[model samples]
Target: MHHHAFSRRSAGIHSLPVELLTRIFVLGSQFEYLYEDSPFLLKPVQDYSPAEAPNLQVIVSHVCRHWRQVALRTPSLWTTLHFRKISHIQRATMYLSRCSLSGTSNTYLLDILIDTVAEEDYLPGINLYKNELRTIFQAIVPHVRRWRAFHLKICDDDCKAQARQYLSACGPAPSLETLQLYHFTDYRTAQRLYLATYRPPVIVFSNTLPRLKNVSLIGVNLPWDKSPFLQDLHHLELALHLDNIRTPYAYWDRMLRLSPELRTLCLHYSGPKEATAADPALIWPNLDDKIQLRSLQELSVTDLDPDYLCQVIQRLHIPNVNKLTLDLPDQNFTPFVELLTNSAATGSTDNTGRASNTQASSRFHPMEHSSPSTTPPDSPILSLRNLETLIVRALECSPSSLISLLRATQALRVLQVDFSRVGGGLCQIFNQDPGITPSAASLASTGFVHHPLLPLLKIMKVAGTPGKDILNTLHTRHRLSREPPAVSEKWIIGWDEKRRGTDAELDALVDKGYWSFTGQGRKVRVIIETYDDEEEVEEVPDNDAESGDDDELEDEP
Candidate 1:
């Protein structure tokens, strides 16, 4: 009976049109790459092994005669090549040869990933050497013109030197669009010791990549003035850059000006050097003349120096940013707060099509809008009118500043905050009663008004358990509203096991049906997730990559 069912299913799939079947095979081969919150680091879920990787084309070609014909003819299925072990060199060559024989007129572009980092249990009694990597690079370097995306991961110093040699030796890559190079080493320790031996400079394709739009480099340096691929990039990420080989401020300014079409920019402890009088050659931009990044949508700056971060933020004019992530140190949020305050004072539009500064003052009687003393007509304004999602880590700001920031961003839909580093005063805003009157002490001290905050919020994720205050806010928003309530759809709370007794009130609220509102076929969901500690919880990163133990890959043979 099982064999009959399998045969019937197989017949149904085989009866589809040839074009549709080929597309299905092509779509099935594509996989998503997962990264950590820090964009440069890949999520290390398990040990790297070549045998565990997915090979969708090989599986479909070995299934049956009809399926094999369709799979062999689909050229897109053989574009991605993975080389992690010495044994995989043969497989990479096989993929290239299969693409040529797929009966296509034009040459297919390749997306190659070469990981030279050795794992202990990958292959017993065998280690990947420099010559093995060179052999693999030599085989693919000949087809540099047909490369679309190239990713290289090296752990050893010797392999780094060889990779740089091969990259410099290659000629122009006209079709290359994405380039990523990662050195798996702790850059913090290296920076502390000023160790220049482990961190080597990388020069790719001899500055000949014209079509490159996405670039990610971690623990590597490139001569910024000589590289041509750094301009007009759609996505650029640089992390863990050493101070000894820092790029000057002038080059950094020029690069940002050239990349006007950038959509995503992530600078994690990397960018220009700090502005100091000691380096007279490092010319800083004037406050009035800012580099306009009108097309940028997503921006991330993590682990940057506070003074330098302020200088960088003041020099850019980003008006359409919708998603922002900041992982800064405590008491380092003044710059961002000033941006929000200035945006509100400059009469930026709110969600209600009114000036945010006026709306904020009219909605709350006690709160006042404080504008800067001096105003310039042509000053660059960083507007948060279109901001929808915000994620902040290690945020520590005053209550008034936080209030002004929240008022400016009335269109926020999703908010994620690390409450472990926040002060008690900031958390009180979440518990503010929207229906009740404000007390005399509250109005005098914090000038907080009993008004609804973040009315359009749909999802909220808190890194620490927010006990009864969060519950009170949610209940008030749902039950005590004159107009239609904009209650959040989902609230995810990360509970620490150490705070077991403190979450009793939160548990009681959930037991009671505070979230079971049936208004216009809408209901709220509250998710309580428990974790051991910060280190243990952070170790398990996002699993957005293709699963290694997939049933389809296992059943291919």
Candidate 2:
């Protein structure tokens, strides 16, 4: 009855050696099909290719049959897919199915990009893909238990609303640990999701999340009155666009009420600068004693006012906080800087070894060290003797004042100052005593530094036109103290030719024997022999004219 069918087995696969089997399992497990040449996930041949992203994967497959099978089985290598277009979505999903975590009974984690912000800006491009958002969400929404991570960005408000409605309808994410809502059009969907089923004395989460660990709000604002919906999160990031409309400080006051398991909190104060802006922290009545951020260890801030920034630092007793970063305001307020450093509760805090070293690295930085005259920050103002990394940004400061700042720091090792910050109103500074200017004047400690000085100072950075003079001054100090020439040899004085320094040339600085290399470092470093710009008037010329006038006067008489 019949022609029997014969199935050809891979020749060596049946009797493959144990070592070969293990290597093949490792290779197949590690190999990602998306990295291989298939119509589904093909990448352009270039220096940077996804094929290269899976370099180790593709190479192992060719090593042997066993290796190829092993490389094909690894889920971690197959996890993330960059769905550039609608057409690629179905194909990427097919490949992702191979790494399905059903075997591990764990959800697979994937980073998906439906549309980029810039891509949404183009009209035709958005119209082409606008409808795909709903379709894609529909497919993935049902498998919510499998979703380890999801980010959907759609520009069309209608599409965004649909996506939001679907997610808000999906109920609470039990397996979902990470959620990022970027460019969300309708926040009310979330508002209703968190508040609709519950009412408040506003204690939102009650035996809430056991798995949800991280949540970030970017370009999203929660109601000033709304409490945080996620409970027991290990990390929280909040980046807000306040529409310049100041919300109540009690809004933030609510976040502090959470379980102290929180390790990192990134909060930003953003709102439109309304016709008049109000300070929320000052107005909040309950803020008087809520300073304890129980489990919070690290804090980061950006583009905030000096006063409010200080209030946050002073209020929060972050015992585990060993790292601090300050993006100094243009106003150059150091007291504000000091408030942030005060957050580190020293002595009571033992951050010795790695922790203490990290604390040591975060100290104040001098504006310029290679300059003939050094200018730096007033360290007592920042009060971070335990700081580890000090990053000073564009600083346009008077030479004498900056030098005073450097002299004040007792633990400064790394210093950076970019002269670009010298705002145009600079003419306004010199006309008045520079030390009296707003930034330098009001600092709790005067820009005039008074300290034994940092003994561990190292790594000096200064850039921009104005830095030239300051850098030269620093080099002179280094030379005298034999400061081991920490500066780069290629550090030419005139690196920044754009600003071109001042109308009045630099006055010479004389040392014990060596002629001081003075003058702004940007232009020709005018190595002067002596400090004389004025010549003495010859007495002989004056005397000859006086005698001639006297003789003429006698003749006339």
Candidate 3:
């Protein structure tokens, strides 16, 4: 019986055509390498040995003679090459040789990733020397014309200099589509290095990389004004540069103008330098003529100066943006709040800076406060009507200001807020009966009365211990008789020695069925997660009360 089953399996394997087998091999290789999610550079750098080169191709080729023949004919499977360790040199060469055996005049394009550390901090004894690095580059430099994406990550200053020297002279890359250069160093060290050895910007590619559509540079500076590589990009990420070495607003404006089709822009502690009285000219060209970014869909600005962030927001028009993430650590939220509230007064400006008459009448105007001196009566709130997901961290603002911001996002579907980092009274806005609570009543008197706060919201995620306000909010939403009655809520609580008894309240809520379905036949799913000192605790399963099965809650440590 075993022999007959093996015979049937072998026959089924051989029945597939060579083209289909090759295609399967290609997809398997890509999945092993995570080809679609290439350039995993945003993650924190770790001092570990390089991952073993994916052996999927080699393993399949050794399965049988027929599989070997099919794998040998597929060149695209070997296009992704990584050279992070000394042993990888041999593997890279073998992959390149296989790509050359396609029997075609034009070889397949290459997606290369070079990640290395200095000799002193080498992994175990496998130190990647400068000569070895240069040799690897020399081999790939010949195929620069067929380069599809290049990612370079260096850990120390010496390796950074070596990489810059080689890349500066690599010449024009006609087929290069994505370029990412990251100097991986600790935050303090990077800041010190930039301040100590500040120098004029250097040009990397003398010829414009015409096809380059994505560029990410961290702790690296380029001639922003003259670099042709910054034009027509679809995604741009810049971070960790010191203020003195940062580009001014004019350079950023120029790059935005050149990349009209840019879809994603992320600035982390890096953007136009802040304006000061000593150099007032830095805020040049009259920001009144805002740059229109109609194609921008995702925007993230973190650890930025409030004035600089306000200037950046005021100088652009992102009408179609759907995702926004902001980290506000400062107490001065006036500038940001004013921007959010006054956007509607700009006459509903479109991407072309033309005022549309249709939305002018529908603009949001806050109600008159009893004390007119404290409120801006005619101020129009910004219409972030298209925003669907918002993640706010370390936001310090008044409850009224937070209400105003939430009021603008009528179409929000997902909201994630770190309650530990947020100011007090912001969480109370979720309570259904606003007239009874002072904070909620104050928010209601504002623009929140016309419509519910984020009525279309489907998922609300909060980080911090669960509180009565959050429980009340959940209870109120779940009891509603509306079509979209309730939202799925998740609470992330941090456990520590001092905070051992904090979960008692949450435990009581679960026992009282506050996280279960309401009498109205609407269900509210609640997820409770705990972590201790950045170490994740075991995740509890989602409590789906719809089944009427009560699961006992585990005590968090």
Name the candidate that leads on TM-score.
1
Compute each candidate's TM-score over C-alphas: 0.76, 0.54, 0.76
Per-residue error (Å), model 2, residue 303: 2.3
Candidate 2 C-alpha lDDT tens digits along 1-557: 13332234434365667566656555664455442322112111111112212334434445565555554566554554443344445544544664575675254555444543223344443222545566666656555665554544443445545555676566544565656554433334666434322222222123233466766655544344443455566666655445332334444444554545877665554422222124433243211233355466456565666544544444344544433433444654454432333323321111111112211122211121121111111111123444433444433334444444444343555554444553322222212233332322333344433121344645434444343244334333333231223222222222322322441232122222223221222222222222211223322112222221221222231
- For model 3 the local lDDT of residue 56 reads 71
- Model 1 per-residue lDDT at 260: 84
How should the candidates be ordered by TM-score, best one leading? 1, 3, 2
Give candidate 1's whole-model lDDT.
0.63
Instruction: Give the alpha-carbon lDDT of every model.
Output: 0.63, 0.41, 0.64
Rank candidates, lDDT, best first: 3, 1, 2
lDDT of 1 by residue, 288-389 (tens): 345678899998887776656655665567778899887876554665566555743544332222233322222212211121113232343556768898
Show the lowest summed lDDT stretch of 10 residues, model 1: 364-373
